[model samples]
Target: MVVGARRVTRLLDAVQLGMVVLVLVAPVAWMVLSAFKPRTEVAALPPRLVFTPTLENFAELFQRTDFLENTVNSLIVAGGSTALGLLLAFPAAFAMSWHRMTWPATATLFARMAPGTLFLLPWLMMFTALGLVGSHLALILTHAVITLPVAIWVLLPYFDALPREIIESAEIDGCRQHQTLLRVALPMVAPGVVVAAILCFVFSWNYFLFALVLSGFDSKTAIVASFNFIGEGVTNWGALMAAATVIALPPLILTLIIQRRLVGGLSAGAVKG
Candidate 1:
């Protein structure tokens, strides 16, 4: 009876897993396939499962638009925001963990939890008044608001898991606060830092509204540029799909490269040792 029950549970789990995969993977698969499909076939009734793939959409994306340039812009903003978030968050998280400062962490969380649109108008006016509208610097700084809270929250658990004796020993060894953070606590939480950085980069890379409102021609992100495919009467579905596929590549590659580490980092703080 127990063996039969176990088999039923396993079968249920497999069914749930397959459903989840289908829901997530189907759209991505369709997008990638459509990126290579001819323009006429993209929205064809009853999609073509067997069709000759072509590079025309990709060529159109690169040659006809500033998508390549916009991709470079996205990279710059995402990388900048990730670095800035880590720099600020690492020490902040360590301090919060060490001192048991819950309020500050809560404040940061509140900022994150608030609708992003809430800050948009204020930021727009402030940047415009500072003559900073349409600059990559503006995008990076605004994106920091998105990345900072994520880094802080992700790293906080890792810092909380640190042994008190290790921190006390560092202090006893004459390491100052900054030195302790930089040399001791920082090294111990390296996995958490990696996870935080990956999340920050992914968030900033995909963020669109800020870039759409603030960016100039020179600083437009690929996500914002992809909107060009949509017009009043005609939507370039194939080209849009191509742009999306390209935009999704960097984060996908980065995640794939560090997948093992990412999984380890996420699970590391789940249980105290």
Candidate 2:
């Protein structure tokens, strides 16, 4: 009886896992499949599970639109913001962890938790005044607000997990704070840094609101440009799906490539040693 019950539990677990995978993967699968489908098949009465794939949508996305340029713009913004966020966050997180300061981290979290809309008007006005509206600089700086807090939070745990004895040893060895951070501590927490950077890049890459409002024609991101496919009365379903597939590629590839490290980094500091 016990053996039979264990089998039933195993079957139930498999079913639950399957359901979760389907829920998470189905939309992505549909988007990719639809990107290859012709326009008629994309919007067919019942979605066509079998159809001859076409490259027309991808061709149109590249030839008829500035999506490639927009993608470059996104790369610039996301990369710049990620770099900027890490530069600032690395020191801040280390200091916070060293000093055992929670309020500052809490404050940054509060800033992050606050509505993105709250800062939009002020950012718009400031950027306009500075003549940076619609520039990559504006988008990068604004996206930093999203990336910075995330980098801080992700790195905080790793910093906390550092050995106090090692840090003190560095200090005794004539290493200044920045020296210790750059030399000793940095190497030890390298995995956490990778995790933080990937998260920051992904967050900044996917952020839509700031880019939409701040970007000009040349600096518009792929995500904002993808929105153009939708119209009041008519939408280009095929092209939209193609654009989505394209836009999703970079982050998707990055995550898949580093998934093991990402998982390890996240779990690394969960328990105190």
Candidate 3:
């Protein structure tokens, strides 16, 4: 009876894991499948699973819009935000985590938890007043608000876990706070930095609210541009899915390529006090 129960438990566990995977994979699989489908097949009443694939959706997506330019905008905004966030967050994270300052870290967490839309109205008003509307600077700075908090959160535990002796040694050598951060702490937390940057880039790239509200024709990102397929009367499912597939590729590729480092960095932080 005991052996039978154990077997049943293992079987249930396997079934649960399979279900979880299916839930996560189903949408992505459908998106990829739809991207290859022709326009008619994309919205067929009874979804067609085995339709002949075509590249026309991609061709039309590029031809009908500034797809390449939007892609460049995404890259620039995401990259700039990630870089700026890292620079701002590194010192702040060090102060909070190394010193065990809970309040500062909590404040950053609060900001991150607040809905993106919560800030939109005020941001729009402020930027409009400053005549900064529709500028790359506006989008990049707004994206930094998201990416900065993330950088701080991800790096905090890593900084907290650093060997106390090394920090003390750096101090003993008469190193200033900034010097210690540059010469000692950052090098030690390089893996965490990489993980944080990758995550920040992904977040900034996919963030739609800020870009949609703040960007103009010259600075619109691929994510906001993807919305063009959804019209008042007719939605182009194939083209929309094609754009989503293309937009998803960069972050997906980056994550897959650095998955090892990302996992290792998180695991290391998990064991830290």
What's the number of clashes in each of the models? 0, 1, 0
Error (Å) of candidate 1 at residue 151 is 0.5
Q: Which residue pairs come into collision in candidate 3?
A: none
lDDT of 1 at 145: 93
TM-score of each: 0.87, 0.90, 0.87
Q: Determine which window of 10 residues in candidate 2 has minimal summed lDDT.
A: 227-236
> What ranking emerges by TM-score with the best candidate at the front?
2, 1, 3
TM-score of 3: 0.87
Q: For model 2, name the residue pairs that clash.
A: 134-216
Worst 10 residues of 1 by lDDT: 226-235
User: Hey, what RMSD does candidate 2 come out at?
Assistant: 2.6
Q: Please identify model 1 stretches exceeding 4 Å from their true place.
A: 1-16, 231-234, 256-273
How accurate locally, in lDDT, is each candidate? 0.90, 0.90, 0.89
Off by over 4 Å in 3: 174-176, 232-234, 257-273
